[model samples]
Target: MNCYQKEDLIKMVEDAKQLTQKGKVADYIPALGEADPSTLAVAIYSGERECIYAGNIDEVFTLQSISKVLTLALALMDRGADYVFQRVGMEPTGDPFNSISKLESSVPSKPLNPMINAGALAVTDMLVGNTIEDKLERLLNFIRQLTGNDRITYNPVVAQSEFETADLNRSLCYFMRQHGIVESNVEQLINLYTKHCAIEMNCNDLAKLGFVIGNEGRDPNSDQNIIPLEIARIVKTFMVTCGMYNASGEFAIKVGIPAKSGVSGGILGSVPHGVGIGIYGPALDDKGNSIGGLRLLELIAKQSNLSIF
Candidate 1:
């Protein structure tokens, strides 16, 4: 396969940004709800090169559900996959991310997988640091290492807004607590989990962050292991199987790349040995994926022949 020229890729992003005009901006988190639905941006990066950003490229957005990937990988590294799996399954649930039917079923299972809310809470509980502050600090440090952006930090407004509006997630925690899947104090665990979701980032930062997975857990730019290779594979598999909420299957059939999306309107896509893409379009489809972001990825993968399949 041939590499894409940076300028060509940039034009593609510019072309794709037009998709934003057709989407509706996110409006649930209150803070996120206010994002201009028409806002769109894209960032692409590889081990040694970076290319084009259109529209709000520098605008900071919360990681939202995308934080699940980072915390799950770190939890796996800290506590091993076996222990983590015991609290969260590795299957896709073709249901809304916040579905309670599976949780209420007879098997009384762990969350269907780590990309969902229940699974992410379980993984957050597994982080090995001493205190909430310690755990968050470790997570932040880990994120900065992966993205090569040491100044990154959590956004308090987003955290507070999520905390205030997360009754469904709160209910999920309480349910897990009842089921013995989440051993941490329900309130504390949810707090830590939401704050991590509030970790702020932009398109460029997310693309660079995704490189850790695209390059098999190594920070290609720094030549260091941000995530162990084995852990990276597991995380990537989760991205393929459960990343786009209930749309994972469709995305696999269509775009065919490992990816994760956040309700805050960001998608992090992995194109191994080529590029990691970050797309932002606040509007969401019924499944909660970035409407424009999804279109942009499909177009790029088709044009650049980046599909893993």
Candidate 2:
């Protein structure tokens, strides 16, 4: 099967919009709650010059959990896998992303994986910096390099909203502290996590980032290696197994590619040696995946035989 043509991809985008009603916008954060539920968009990149877009492709949204993938890669690069893995396990939790129960039940209390809230918080703590500002700048710069866009930035309003409503996350952080899993200042770590989650980008930016990962950590445009090949392989493995939160198993069985979803209704997908896909739809299913976005990916994967399985 061939890569999807621009016209056919646009049609797929249009057809997937009907699924918007099947999910609801993520409103618990208040900032994410403001997204227009009817909006849907997609962008695909195979090379620097080969790009396809459809729907509200220009609309900017927060990275949310999708940022975790980048942070995990950075942590792996900054600190080797052994050090990072010591604080966080590699297995999926089979629980909700924000579940506190898993933290309580685990014997040693290490976060199950870097994709969950607990694990991401611990990974965020590993980002070497003297202050939260320094750490955030490092993260944003890394993302800018990945997408080849220097203009990427954080959404302060969204960050503030999450901070104000972060009682549960605070609890998780303190729980980690209690168990010796995280030793950083709780407020500072939460602030950094929330701020990174608030980083804003459009489908095109995400597709470009995915493009680099799809090609095994090399920038397709500059032909430069961004992330080490080994690190990229580890990150992609985690994305395939744990990226979609508790719904990861179902998504793997259906989509059969490495992908990550955010509550902001964005999904980042990479088809090894094939293409990178970015999708945005603010309506979230019960499992916190973008309803329309997942539908679009299923259609594309099925039609193009994009599934790795």
Candidate 3:
């Protein structure tokens, strides 16, 4: 249950950075396309005295799909498991995170899981708010509380960029609306979704948040409960199964821990009762995960035997 020394972490970060050159930065989102693919960073927090950091650990990036884990946790806290499960199923879709085909083909039209874009949208729609602004604020505040960082906020430019190029997401929302799955206003819900996805944080912030989850929803530093233990377990399970888009299985085999990745090249991982690891590598593999980030996790897992499996 020991954590890596700071020197070891720095060496691993340097090694992982080598893989960044082999991957491509996400270009689908115009804002994300501008990210420097060579930038690589990682932070590890043990929820105690040890905090290891390396590379551009202070570099901020949008949460992208990584925010789905937060929104899902908040939705569970707000609506409970039974009500939330009614909207999104527990199984993996096997399709890409943004694929619309599964929504069209699945019987009863429910999203296969909350980690996917459709399911995340459905979960976002379920957030209780009189307006989209209220919902976004509430979610942002929740993230701040979880990470103990009040300065965390969304990147407006990234939000606007995603909104402009979100025809596919818009189509998914409307289709769900037609099927009676999403009852909220499509535009407002989409805006909220984009806002959460654009929420920005550095690797250290991610480690702080993941540390809470690793400690079973309690802020180990303050010894306060941020989320109920049962709910935290549920969210972590989803991360282990569906967090890395279609590549979740491979990631599980390689890293053997619960993790969520964002297109902005962020990955949040919780090693149950152990450590919280956050990584940023703008370059992506075919499965849309941070290429160098995944390599880094695999290296840590192998060297440290960090995997729960």
Measured by lDDT, the strongest candidate is 2
Cα lDDT tens digits for candidate 2, 1-309:
224477898888889999998889999999999899989999888875756888988899999999999999999999999999999999998899999898898888889999999999999999999999999999999999999889999999999999999999999999999998888999989999999999999999999899888789999878898999999999999999999999999999998999999999999998888788889999999999999999999998998888888
Q: List the residue pairs that clash in candidate 1.
A: 24-283, 25-37, 27-33
Query: Would you list the clashing residue pairs of candidate 3?
Result: none
Model 3 local distance difference test score = 0.91
Better of 1 and 2 by TM-score: 2
Winner on TM-score (1 vs 3): 3
Model 2 segments beyond 4 Å from truth? Answer: 1-4
Runs in model 1 deviating more than 4 A are: 1-7
lDDT of 2 at 88: 97
Give the Cα error of residue 262 in candidate 2, in Å: 0.3
The per-prediction tally of clashing pairs is 3, 0, 0
Write the residue-wise lDDT of candidate 3 on 104-214 in tens digits. 888988889999999999999989889999999999999998888899999999999999889999999999999988999888888899999999999999988998998
- lDDT of the structure predicted as candidate 2: 0.92
Q: Can you give the TM-score per candidate against the true fold?
A: 0.95, 0.98, 0.97
Worst 10 residues of 1 by lDDT: 1-10
